[model samples]
Target: MNAENPQSPPVASVPLYQLKAEFFKTLGHPVRIRVLELLSTRDHAVAEMLPEVGVEPANLSQQLAVLRRAKLVHARREGSTVVYTLASAEVADLLRVARSIIGSLITDQAGLLADLRAADRG
Candidate 1:
C-alpha cells in the first residue's frame, strides 16, 4: 500500500467509539426523544409543546436545548415565540423506526411479565 495515495479515503481524526458514545449520550434521555417525536410531526412553539409532551416548562426547555445543541432540531422565530422543527424529514423517519423498536420491546416485556405472574400463582 502506498503511503501517499491520493485515491485513499481520508481517515477520521475522531475515533468511531468516541462518536458513538456521544451519539448515545445525546439520545439517552426520554424527554429529548419526545421532543424529537413532536418536531417530527410539525414545527411547534415551546409553550405549545409543554402541554402535549406533559413536561414542565423548565424541563422541556432543557431537553429542547439539548436537541438544539445536537443539531437534531432547528428553531425559527415567530413573533415573540420560537418555533421548532426537525432538521430534516429523515429525522421523522428515524423517530418512526425508533418508536417501532420501542413498541416491540414493550410488548415483549409485557408478555414476559404476564408469564412470570402466572408461574408465581401456579
Candidate 2:
C-alpha cells in the first residue's frame, strides 16, 4: 500500500519461502502434529480429543489455537463443545505422503542394518 493512496491493494511483505517456512514451523510441534493427525481422521470435539491427545486441557487449547491461526484447521461450536476439522482434505493427503516417505526411509535403514549384521556374523 502506498502512503499517498488510501485505497491501494495490500502488497505481500513476506517472501513465499518465508511464508512456507513459517507454515512448516507451525507444524513443528509434536502436540500440534498429533492434533492435526486426529483431525485428519474426523472432526473431533475438544472433550473427545482430550483423551486421545493425552494433553492437559489448557495445553490442547493452546495447540488448537496455533492450528487455527495457521488456517490448517477449523473450529465450530456444537452446543457447549468445540468441534475441529481439517481446513482442507489436502492436509490428510500431506500426512499420508509424510508417512510414506518416513516408511521408505526406515525400510532403507533396516536394510542397511541387516547388511551390517550379516557382515558381523561372517
Candidate 3:
C-alpha cells in the first residue's frame, strides 16, 4: 500500500451494489444515454453529435461532462474538434442488453393485454 494513496483500497472494498447504483445514476439522463448509444458505434465530434442529438451545444456539453466524470466516455481533441468515444466495448454491450430487456417486457405486456381482452369477451 502506498502511503500516498491509502484511499485506493477502500474504493475497491466498496459493495458492488453501491457501485452499480452509482453507475445507473450516471445513466439516468436521456442526453447521456443518447450520447453513449451514438458513441457505441464510432467516435464522433461535438459538432457532428449536436444535430443528431438535437440539443444545444451547452446542453450537450453538460451531458458530456457527466459521462466524462463517470468514466464512460473518452474525449480527444483533433484540431478544434472534440471527438468522443465509449471508454470500453462493455458499455455497448450494456446498451444492447437494455434494448433486449425492454423489447421482451413490451412483448410480455402485449401478451397479457391480449389475454385480458379475450377473457373479457368470453
Off by over 4 Å in 2: 2-9
lDDT of each: 0.87, 0.93, 0.93
Q: Can you rank all candidates by TM-score, best first?
A: 2, 3, 1
Candidate 2: lDDT over CA atoms?
0.93
Q: Note the residue pairs that clash in candidate 2.
A: none
Measured on C-alpha atoms, candidate 1 has an lDDT of 0.87
lDDT of 3 by residue, 1-122 (tens): 54669755533468989989999999998899999999989999999899989999999999999999889999999998899999999999999999999999999999999999999999
TM-score of 2: 0.90
Off by over 4 Å in 1: 1-12, 107-122
lDDT tens digits, residue span 8-121, model 2: 967658998999899889999999989989988899999999999899999999999999988999999988989999999999999899999999999999999999999999
TM-score of 1: 0.73
TM-score of 3: 0.90
Point out the higher-scoring one by lDDT: 1 or 3: 3
**Candidate 3 lDDT trough over 10 residues, lowest sum:** 2-11
The clash numbers for all candidates, in the given order, read: 0, 0, 0
